[model samples]
Target chain A: MANTHISYTALPGRSRPYFGVLYLVELVFTFGLLAIGERTRLYLGPDHLLVLRRRFFTETAHRFYFSDIQAITVQRTTNAVTANAVLFLLCALTLGVLGLYPFSGGMILLGDFSFGEELLLILACAGFGLGLALNILLGPACVTELITAVSREPLPCLSRWGTAQRALALLVPRIETAQGVPSPEFLNVQPVLAAYATPAGRLITQPPITHDSGRLHELLFGLYLLMSVSCMIDLTGNWMIKNAFDSLLFMIVLVLSCIALLRQRHSDIPSDIRSLTGFALGFSVLLFYFTRPFTMLHMFWNMPENFDPAILMSSMLNPDDPLYVAYVGTQLAVDLFVGLLGLLGIYRFRRLYRLAQHNAALDTPPPPASNVEEPPAAP
Target chain B: MSTALTAWSGTACPRCGREMERLPSNSVEPRVCPHCKTSFIALLFPAAVQNEFLGRYGEPLREESEAACFYHADKRAETACDRCGRFLCALCAIDTQDKRYCPQCLENGIRSGELPEFQSAYPRHDLLALAVACIPLMLAIPILLIVLPWATDIALGFALGLLLFPAFVTAPASLYLALRFRKTVTHPLGRRAGWFPLTVLLAAGQMVVWAVAIIVFTGSLFSEF
Candidate 1:
C-alpha cells in the first residue's frame, strides 16, 4: 500500500571518481569519445513493476505483475572480470617483452609539451598495472534477475547490489503472498498465462525484433561488392585472365550471400536460410583462402618499380622478390583473419535463425476444439 | 472476507473481453466469464496511500516568513543544497541518494568531476593497448609516403626501422592487451575495442617482410661492392 514510487538509475561501477579523471585525461590527450546513451529506469506500481529503457532513438517499456513473478535471484557475472584479467596479463607480458628491447633516447613533442620516450613508456605501463589491480579487486559485477515461468527470458531488475536488494525487499513479499493462494490449477497456471495472457499481450503486440543483423549483412555485402568491383576494374584494365576468373568467383559468392541474407529475413523455415547462409559463408572463406596467392601476385605486379621491362617481368615471376614476399605474407594474414570472422558470423546467424523459429512457433495460434462428444459429468 | 474478493470485481477476462464475476469457493479461485467460457485470475490489492516523506512546494511568500530560495526569490526554501548550502525550493531541488542539491551546485559538481554518478563512460585500458600496438605502424604509412618516392636503400631502411618499433613493441603489446580485455561490460564510446590481435598479427607480418627485405637488399648491395 506504499504510495511512494521508487526510482533509481543503474550506473556502471567502473565510473568512479578516479576513473572519471582518467577519462577526462584520455579525452583531452587522445581525442576519445565516451558518451552513455541508453538508460534503464524502474517504477514500482501498486500491483505491478514497470521497467523503462530509454535509448537514443526509442524507449521501450515492460510491465510485470507480482502474480507472474516466480522468484528473484541475485548473482555476480564474472565475464567482464575474467576478460579484464586476461587483458592485464597480456599487457604485462607485452611490457616484459618491451623491456628486453634496447632502449634508445628520443623525445616526442606535442604542441608546447615534450614527452620523453622512457617517461611515456613508464606511464603506459603504470596505467595498465593500475587497471589490472582494479579489475582484480572489483571481481565481478552483480546482477539481480527476476525468474518467471511465463517466458524463457530472464528479467534483469538491476546491476548494483543496493538497488537490487531494495527492489527484492519490495517485490519478494508480494510474490510470496500471490503464490500462497491455494487454487485447483496451480501447476497449469504458467502455461495458461503463457498461452493466453503474457505472450499474447506482449510478444504478439510488439515483436522484439532487432535489425542489427540485417544492417551488418548489408555492410559486409556492400564492402564485398565494392572490393569485387574495384578488383574487376583493375583486372579489366590489366587484361589478366586468372585475376578476372578469381574476382568473378568471389563476386558470385558475395552476391549469393547477399541474396541468402535477404531471403533469410522473410523465410518462415529456419533450416532453409541456415543452410544457404552457411554455404555462402563457408564458400567465401574457401574462396578467399584459395585465391590469396594469385591476389598477392597481382598486387606485386602492379607495384611501381624502376627495373627494365625484362627484369620487371622476371622479378614478377620470381616468388623471392623481397617486397612481393612481404606483400604475400601480409595478404595471407589478412585472409586468415577474415576467414575466422566469417566462421563466427556463420555460427551467430544459425543461432539467430533458430531463435526466430522458436519465437515464431510460440506466436502460432492453438488448434480449434474438435466436435467429438464428451461423457456426462458425474452428479 | 468477501470484501477482499470485491476488490477484483471489474476486471475483464483476457481472452473473451467480458466482465468476470468471482465464483464462490473455499480459497481464491479464477473468475469465470459469464458471457464466454474463458476464465482469468484477477489482481486484488489495497489502493496505494499518499507518500508523506516528500516535501510539498509552498505558496509564494508575500512577507518572507523564512529564508527564500536562491533560484526563486518568491518561493519559500524547503532545503539547503548538500554541497553549496544554497537554499533550494522544490522546483529547483534535485534529489540524489538522500541528499538534495540546487541545479547550479549539481552542474558544478558534475563539471568539476566531483560526482561519479554523472560520468557517462570510463576510459578503456584495452583501447590504450591497441593504440600502442597500432599507432606506430599507422605512423609508418606517412613515413613511407615521404621516403618511398625518394628511392634510396638507406631511407627505406630508416623507414622500416621506424615502423619496426610499433610492429614489434606495440603490436605484441596490443595483441596481449586485446586478448586480456576481450570481454567488456559496457560500451565505452558506444563501441568495444576493434580486433587488436588481427591488426597486431598483420603488423608483425609486415615487419618480418620488411626486415627480410632489408637483409636481402643489404646482402645484394654487399655482393655488388
Candidate 2:
C-alpha cells in the first residue's frame, strides 16, 4: 500500500460567489480583490481529504478517508451563466464611463475626487475587468461532491469544470490506491446495488411532509410590492402623500423578507420563488445603502455652522438634493421591478407547490381512513 | 429518522433522484444525467456493490446460558457497550470509530459532545488572531482613503492618530489570541500553524509603530499647552 500520510497538496479553487454583494464592502474598505468571500478550501492529506470551511470566526474541518470514499460526482451549475452576464454588463458600463471621460473634460460628474482618488477608482475598475476575464476564462461552473457510504460532502473549491477534473486527477489515484480497483466482473455494474442499498427502509423519493409555510412567500412579495409603491409615491412628493410611512414600510419588508427566506429554505416551494426571495432581500439592502456615500458627501458639503446631532440625522434622511433624488429614484424603480418579479414568482411557486402536494396526496395510501372505516359505521 | 439518514450513495443525480450512469473502472469522462440533464461525473467503488448491512435483527435466545440483550430481552447480547457497560445486541450496538456504545450511550455522547469527532464546528483561534491583527489595518485603509486627498499633512497626522489609538487595543488583543489559541487544530496541509505566529509578529510590529506615533503625538500636544 502506498504511504498515504506524508505528502499533502492544496486543491485549486476557493468556495465563494463569483461576486458577493459583500465584495462591495471589501472594495470600498480595502480596495483589494472584489471577489473575496467565505473561503472553503480542500486539502489532499495522507490519510484523508480535509475540507477547511471558514465562515466568520468558525472553521469546520470535515475529513473523508480515501478507503471509505465510494464515489466522486461533479455536476454543472448555472452559477457560471449568471456570473458571466453580470460581469459582462459591469465591463460594458465601466468601458462606457472610461470612453466618456475624455469628452466630459477633467470634471467627474459623480463627485469631485483628487488625482490620487481617481487613480484608485481606475485601479478598482481594472480589478473588476480582471474578474470578468477570470470568470470567462474558467468556463462553466460545477459543484463537485465526494460520496462515502455514510456521508456526501461538497468540495467547494472545485467549483469549475476544469478545476474539478484536475481535482479528480489528484483524488482518483489516491482513492484507487487506497482501495484496489474493482474486478472486471463488476466493472460495469449499473448502480443495481445502490438501488438495493437505498439506505434500507427509505424510498427513492422522500415522503412529502410539507405544511403550508403560512403563505410566507405571498406575504413577503406583497410587502415588497407595498414598499416599492410607497417609496415611488414618496419620491413623487405629490399632494397628501404619506412619506413618513416609507421607512416603516421598508422595515416591514426587511423583516418579512428575512423571515420568509429562512422559513422557505428547505420547503417544497419552487426554486425560482426562493431565488426571488433572496433577491428581494438583497435588492432591498442595495436600495438602502447604494446611495449612502453620495448622500454623506452631500451632507458634508452642506454642513451648517452649528452641526447639531438632530440636524445631521434629519439632513441625511431628507437630503433635499437633486442628485439624491436621481440616485434614490433609480433605486426605487428597480425595487418596484423586483417586487413585481417576486409576485410573479410567488404565483408560479404556489401553482407548482399545490400540484406537487396534490400528486403526493394521491400517491400516499390513506392509512388512518383504512384503519378506522369498516365500510359500515354502526349507524 | 431513517429517511434522514438515507446513505447518499453516488448512485443518482443529486438534484433529481434518477439513477446516474456509473463509470466503469477506467472511464473518467463526465456525463449528464438523462432525467435532470445535469452534467455529472460519478465513480463507484467496490464497496458500492456490497451491501453495507444484511440485517441487524438480533438472534433469538436459543441457549439459556447466553446473556440476553438489555434492550431486547429475547435477543442474545453480542457486545458490551463501551461507554456504559450494558450488554447490547447487534441492533442496539452503535459502532463509531474505535468505541462501541449502546443506542442510549451514543445519543448521550453526541448530545453532551463527549466525542470530539461529532462536534460540528468551533472558532479557530488562529483565524481570530488573524482578524485582530489585520482588522485595524483594514479599517485604516478606508479612513486614509476618505481623508488623505483633502490635505496631505492634516490627513497624515489624523490617520496616524486614528490608527495608533486602535492599534493600542487591537495589537495586544491579537497577541493574547495568538498565545491563547496556540494549540488550535491547525490546517491539515501544515499551512494551518502560521496564522497565529504571523498575528503575533504583526501585533508586535503594530505595537512598536503605535508607541512611536503616540509618543510624538503626545509630545506635540504637551508642547502646544
Candidate 3:
C-alpha cells in the first residue's frame, strides 16, 4: 500500500493591525473587556481534513472526512455594520456637543477654568472620537460557510478570499477523486460558485432566510414593548399629557402584539396577527423618530434661562442630579440608536413573518374534495 | 491479469461474483471479468475490496512453546499491544483504526474520555462561554449583598472591587472561546451564543458607572469640606 502521509498547511496569515489597536484600546480603557485573538491551522490527510483552532486558553480540532462533505459553498454577506458604526458615531458626537455646551457655560461664569477639568474633558472627547473613527474604518467582517449533508447547520469559515480559494482548490479535487464521479450536489451549488467567481465583487441577491425559530423576533418584540411602556410612564410622570396619551396608545398596541407573538411561538401564526405585530413595531419606531425634535423642544423650554453657569456645571458634575446626567448622556442620541435597532428588528421580524406564512402555506393540507351534493350526480 | 493481481487487488464483478482483472497497460481502465464478460470501475468499491483482502488473520499456535498471553496464561501470545506492550492471544487482541490496544488501555481511554471516538458530536462553546461569564458573578454577587449593609466606605470599596474579577477573568475567557469557535459550522445549541460579549460589556459598564459614582460623590463631599 502506498503510504500517504498527512500534510499540514498553515493558512496564510493576514495581519489586522486595526484589530490589534482596537484590542489595545479596549484593554487600556475597559480593562481588557472582551478582547480575543485566534490562530487556525489546516491539516490534509489521505482521506480526511482537520482544522485546528488555537486561542489563549483553549485548543479545539474539528475533523471532516472526504466522504462526509456533501457540498462546499462560498457566501458573502453585506451586513449593516457600517451603518451601525455611523449611528454610534453620531450618538457620540451628539453627546460630546451636549457635554461641551455646559462646559462652555462654566467658562462664561468662571472666566478661567482649572487645568484638571479641561484635561479630563479633552481626554474624554479624544477617546470617544478615536473609538468612533476606528469603528467606521474597520468595515464589516465577512464569513465563509461550508454546508454538509450530515449537519443541517452550515459551518462558518472566516478567511480572506485568496486563502479560502486555495483551500477550496486543495479540497474539491480530492473529494471528486474520492467519490470517483462528478457530484450532482456540486452542480447544484454552481450558482454560488459562479457568484463568487465573478469579478464584480458584489453579493448575489438572495432573500433573507430566518433560521432562529422566532426567538430573536419574540425577544425584540418583548424589548420594544418594555421600551414603549417605559416611555409612556416617563411622559405621564413629566406632565407631557399629549405625548403620554400617544405613548399609552402605542404601548397598548405593542402589548397586544407581544401577546399575539408569544401565542404564535408554538403554533402557526395567522397572517393578520403577524401583520399587526409588524405594523405595531414599525409605527412605534416612526413615532419615536418623529417625536424627537418635539421632545428636545420641550426639554429646552423647561430649562431655567437665567441660572448661573457655575451652578449648572456643579449640578452636571453631581451624580445625584439625575436630570443633568440624563442631559449629558445624550438620551436623544441613545433613543435614535435604539430606534434604528428597532427598525432593524422590524425588518427581521417581517422576514420571519413571511417565512412563517410560507411554511404555514406549505403545511396546510389542500382543502378536501368540496362537499357538493354528489347524490344528484349519482341519480 | 497475473501482473495486476500482484500490484492491485481488483473487485468482484457485480454481475457474476467472479474476481475482475484490469485491462493491460491501462491504470485507470475498467476491470474485466473473464468468466462473466462483465466490466466495471473498481475504484467505486475501493474501500470494500481493500478491507476484504488486507486483513491478515493470526496463525494458530503450533507446539505450545510460545510466550503466554498476559491475561490468559494458557493461551499462546500472537502479538503485543501497541500502547502497553502486553502480549495477547488472538481472542484478546483488539485492533483500532491506527493501533492495537490492550483491554486495560482501552478501558482507561474510555474512562478518561481522551479518545477521539468518545468526543461529543460538536464542541459546546456556548455552554463554555456562559459558564465563564456567569460563574464569577454567581460567586461575587452573594458576597457583595451580604457585606454591603455593614460595610464602611473602605469596605464597600473592597467589596465593589471584587466585581472586577468577573470582568477581567470572564471577559477574556468568553472572548477567547468565541473567537476559537467563530468558524464552527455546526452548533448543537441552535446559533452561537453572542451573550458573552454583551456580558463583558455590561460588566465594564457597571465598573464605569461605579467609578463615576464614586468620583462624583467623593468630589461633592470634598467640595463641601
Candidate 4:
C-alpha cells in the first residue's frame, strides 16, 4: 500500500528522460526518414515496418524508464486503454482506407495527408501512441468498469424496511412468502418516522450533490486527446497544406493543448497526466513554428504600399516592422501560455502526489485484536 | 430502582462487579443493570447512535453485515453460505462462481481455507456478469465494423473465433485435465481475456509497427504491394 503513495518531491526528476527521449527520437527519426525518402525518391513498402519499429521502440523504452509509476488507478487505466484502442483502431482503418488511394478508392479523401508514405508514417505514430496508452489503461479500466457496473445494479432483496424487519422476516420466512404480503410483526412505525434524520436512512431521502471538480480531470483528458490527435494530423499533413493554414492549424492545436494542461493543473489528475504533459511539449514546437509564419505574415501585412516587394520577400521580415513585432508578440504569448501551463501542471501533480502520501499514512492498521471472539458458524 | 447499589458510593460488588462491567444505557429501551442483573430503563443513546458513538469513541461494535450460521439460530456466522443466505462463521464461505452457486450463495458454500480473505472489498463480476458486460461490446462490434475497418475485422474475427476456440480447446482440455486430476479445470476469464483485447492490440499495434518498420527498412521492404 505504501508503494502507491506518490511523493511530490520525487516526481519532477523522474519523467524528464522519457519526455526528452521521445522528443529527440521523433525529431531525428521522422525528419531523417523523410529527408532520405524525399531525397532518394524511394517508396518504402506500401506497409512500412521499420518506421513502425522505431516508434514502438521509443515508446516501449519509456515503460522501463518510467517504471516508478507504482499504482495505476482502475478507472484511469481502463479509460485510457479503451479510448486508446478505439482511436488506434480508427487510425488503422483510416490508413488502410488510404492504402486504396492508388486504386482511386473514394474513402481516401477523409484525410489530407495524400502521400502514401507520409500518411502511413502518421498513422503508425498515432497507432503506437494509442497502444502505449491502452497498455497503461487496461488494468484500471477493468476495475472501474466492474465497479461502475456493480454500483448501478439493484439488490432485489435488500428492501427499504431496514435490517431489523429483514431479520424478523427471516424467522418466519415460509409464512411470509406464502401470504404474499409483508410481515406486520416486523414493522417499526416510530423509527421509520425518525429515519429521515438517520445516517442509514438519509441516503434514501437526499440526492447526492456531485461537485463538477470530479469530472474536470476527465474533461481535460478528453481535450488533451483531441489536441494531440489534431496535432498529429496537422504535422503529418503539413507538407500538403498552405503555409498560412499550417500555422493556423498548429496554433489552434497548441492553444487547445495548453488549455487542457491548464485544466489538468487544477484537477486531481491520474497517472496518464504524464502522457498528456509529454504530448503538450511535442506540440509546442509546432505551435512555435506556426507562429513563425504568422510573424512573417504580420510584417507582410503591415508594409507600406510603396515598399519594394523584393526587399520584403528577401528577408524573413524586418524585425523593427510593426507587423513583425505583432507576429513575434503573438508567438511569444503562445509560448508563455504553454510554459506557464506546464509549470502549473507539474506543481498540481506534485501536490496530488503529496496528498496521496498523506492519505496512505492515515490507513495504518491497529495492532492485532486481543481475546478475539471465536469464528462464527457457517450458515 | 436499585437505590441500594447507588447508595454504595459507586463501589464494586465483591461477587460479580469485576465480571460485570457497567455499560451505558438508554431509558427508553431496556438494558441489564450491572449490579442487579435485571433489565432496567435509563437515559441512554439509541442503538444506532450508540454504535456511531462507539465507532467514534474507538470501541468495537458489531459489523452490520455479520453472517449468521445456517443450522444454528443463536449463532452469528462470519461468512455467508454460497448455497443459502445463511451466515457461515469463518467455516463455510465458498469461492465457486461455477454452476453450483450464484454469487450470494457461493459466498456461503466455500470452505474458509479455500478462499482468500480480502480486507478491502474486491468487487467481483462473475461469468454471467462478464457476459452481460459483453453486451456493450456485442453492440460495439457492428459500430466498430462500420467506423474502424482495417484491423477491427481481425478483432471481429477473433470474437467469432472465441466461440469455436472454447469448444475446440476448452472442451478437450477440460476432459484431459479431469482424467489426470479426477477434477475439473476451468479458467473462465483467462480463456477469453487475451483474444478480444490482444486482437485489438495486435491489430492496432501491428499497423503502427509494420508501417514504421517498412518505412525505416524502406530500401529493404519497399514494394508497391
Query: What are the TM-scores, per candidate, against the unseen true structure?
Result: 0.30, 0.61, 0.39, 0.19
DockQ of each: 0.02, 0.23, 0.03, 0.02
Tens digits of lDDT, candidate 4, B133-175: 2333344444443334334667766655543323333333333
What's the interface RMS deviation of candidate 1?
17.0
Candidate with the larger TM-score of 1 and 4: 1
Task: Candidate 2: list runs displaced more than 4 Å.
Answer: A1-7, A18-38, A104-124, A182-187, A192-379, B1-26, B32-38, B54-123, B151-158, B183-192, B213-225
A1-379, model 2: which lDDT tens digit per residue? 0222346678877665444436557656644322347668887887688787776666666778888777777877656665554455444444544555555464343334455545544765686677778778888888887765554566777888888888788778888888888765565554433332332343453432244444777777777667667666656553223555666777887888888866664455554565566655665574355345434554565566887866565444443434335445655665676678777866766676688789999999768865775676666
In candidate 3, the residue pairs with backbone N, CA or C atoms under 3 Å apart (3 or more residues apart, or in different chains) clash, namely: A155-B185
What tens-digit string does per-residue lDDT give for candidate 1 at B105-154? Answer: 88887667566455433445554554566566556655665565454899
In model 3, state the lDDT of residue B170.
64
Question: Ten-residue segment with the worst summed lDDT in candidate 1 chain A?
Answer: A104-113
Candidate 3 CAPRI assessment class: incorrect
All models, RMSD in angstroms = 19.8, 9.0, 18.6, 25.9
Each candidate's fnat, in order?
A: 0.00, 0.42, 0.00, 0.00
- lDDT per residue for candidate 1 within A1-379, as digits (tens), equals 0112334333222232232334444444333322233345565555666565543323355556766664343443433343454345434533642353333122111111122233433555676676666655654444454434443223333543444555555555555565554343432222222221243344323222233344344344444445445443442233347556756766775676666555554333233223335444644554355335433544443544563665544444344333333333333433344445444555566577679789999999876666556788999
Candidate 1 stretches greater than 4 Å from native: A1-253, A262-267, A275-279, A282-286, A289-294, A298-379, B1-93, B102-107, B117-120, B123-156, B159-225
Question: Each candidate's iRMS in angstroms?
Answer: 17.0, 6.8, 20.8, 25.5
Model 3 chain A: weakest 10-residue lDDT segment is: A190-199
For model 1, how many clashes? Answer: 4
